[model samples]
Target: MLSTAAVSWKEPNVECSIDIGLCPNIKYKHKTAQRRLTLFEDFVAFGGVCVSWRLVMAALKKDFNMLPRVPWLMLAEKDDGSNLRDFYCPMKCKNIYRSMLPKASGKRFFSSQGWLLTIAADHEVNLLHPLSRVQILLPNLTTFSNLEEMATHCTDKLYHNFIQKAVLSSSPSTTSDYAIMVIHGAISKLAFYRRGDNAWTTIETWLSAYSDVIYHEGRFYAIDCWGRIVVCDVNGSCPTRGQIMPVMPNEFTHSLEKLYLVESLGKLLIVLRQGVTTRDDYTHGTTRLRVFELNWEEVQSLGNRALFLGFNSSFSVEASNEIKANCIYFTDDCFEAYYSASFADEGAPNYHPEGGGKDMGIFNLSDGSIEPHFRGRSFDPLSPPMWVTPSF
Candidate 1:
């Protein structure tokens, strides 16, 4: 179990919450630096424990790996009867936070640029910001283009299952001129919706089986399963067709293929991640890396920078910013592909969704060393935990 438990970030009342005072021996613990990790949800409540602890917290601000920090792993919510969500800081502090989020009840979460897209049990959709706690109602996606005949199947959760992946052109909190795109349906397809739009407009394109989509250079780019890309300018109701690029060279194809599209510096990149041969485990571990430039050319390195790749918005950061440079921080994105508990047959393998989270790690690009990013409970199948960059 993690050091953290179910605790509210809110100011606790005098009845239930206990105040933590800094003892005279705290200096000795601070000097030795061997104390157990202390977990709290909010800095206000945490620092307000006592005057001495407040001063201690103020002095610890230079750690640079705490809450309100960017690139946090929004942990997968467990049914621990807390009715709260968890967020883990993986850089240095290694602190786990539990927050009361009633709006997220029975909802699956998808993230992009710190904004989360919540799919309710009844198929209602909403965009939420965790830090600001802002909610924006998006058009409910209860239907798909290819699966027109929904009478035979269960209506509620069937449509959401078809949604393979989603990404944003920009966060709504930052700009009004932003778009929401998703790859959905039985055969993966691209769809987009702008702010204040009542309906999601499906992009008319022949290129299908898209695994991932990313917004780069003012256009939406979707990558198919066969390493092909389609760049299209998503607009109003009358959507335009995307210009499909030629199939990329399949030089790094393997058994379980995964590709991510991201903007490293000022250039577009397609990162290919395949399994290692020596490993016999069912969980996918990344060994080799094949990075490509947008011009169909291969690149050598991401100098002085680190990449955060997962279900959320894939982004790159400068290593000078106290971040682990040239490492890929990935989460439990392979859960749906590997574990389908709801869709499994009677005699299918007993694969749990939480088991696939073991694949989450930091893969060093330089020497290819893989290390655990977060040590905690595994993730849920539908709304697995992922990398979320706070944009406040």
Candidate 2:
């Protein structure tokens, strides 16, 4: 006979948030080296219980890896039965807006050229400046899409089609910004939204089957769901002029999914991902992260470590200034898949979002090692440090 007692997990406060800034005298458990950030408070540490270096090293030894001083975000259970909340660290203005967003999930905030672009699947697109709260809704996207029937097709396609790639680009013209969106399913099309133009332009030039897109030099290079890469010059200055450049042959297993045009230490990087092969000879559909150099001299592929991206291949790649440590910051998801229990679908075979929400990490390009990221429950605040460069 079995005891019929109920098993219940305790709910935590889930109250934590981070204020990205610089701090001095941060000492980690494993090393005597005290590192400092060029951007004073580049990163803020959230929700971690600091322990002694001896214990940290001991933990790493057992895990066969070194422990990082910073954590991306931290999670805590809510005291009540309601939803979880985040209390960000490195501290901040204690504004209502900061409290509204949990440490793990939200639309990514992108700031550039004095303008900030905010996107959330559930919310209206917003363009603003961080210093100022006045935001404007991008002239109704549906209204413009409906004008050409592209909206109807696009709306219908969203339910069936998968988002293979979506990236933001600034053309050399400087007058406009675009969102380069590509989809994979029955067919493929290269879609771009010109800011000032207020309408989307779709191109059926490349077969929408494969995956990967990166802006390198003056062109936007995309790898489709069919394992073919097409490079287009947004500047229209190349000899090929919008011609897709065919490089590596597609004898490999699964189609390519990601590309990184990483500019590090004065070098341009081209990182690609190919699926992993299984022992039974069936492709597991897991992607292996590969690196390359993109320069006029000779493009060279670097590193052979196969990183397990852990999804059926829906992911996003981004880079942050590893200012002090020479690291790379990747969001892993367009949506905040890192948090939110409601978004997770356990019944699905591959229970993960393609573009957002997986284990986000920072790879040290200098040493070829993956930094410890997304520890504890939510992202540790120290994880995504503020990338502040001295203005003067």
lDDT of each: 0.67, 0.35
Q: Lowest-scoring 10 consecutive residues by lDDT in candidate 1?
A: 13-22
lDDT of 1 by residue, 1-392 (tens): 11244445343422222223334534443432322223223443344445565565555533422433346788766776676777776645465655566777667777897788888877777888775568988888654454573344467666446566778888786588888899776677888878877877777778747878998888888888778889888762335688888767555444337777888888889887776222335335566666787655876678877888877878887663336877777876764555554356688654563434556787787777888877776667667678877543
> Which ranges in model 1 have alpha carbons more than 4 Å from their true place?
1-69, 147-156, 236-238, 250-256, 276-283, 320-322, 353-356
- Separately for all candidates shown, the number of backbone clashes (residues 3 or more apart, or on different chains) is 0, 46
1-392 in candidate 2: lDDT tens per residue?
A: 00111211132212222211222234435434332322211211111212232233223232322222221122232334433333222112211112222221343333322233444444344554331233545533342322344344445323222233344454212334444333323344554444564644455554554445555555566655444567665435442234655555545324445544444444445555433222243223323355554432323322322121221111222222321233444434322122222233576333232332234455554564555444433322111211111100
> Best candidate per TM-score, number?
1
CA shift at 223, candidate 1, in angstroms?
0.6
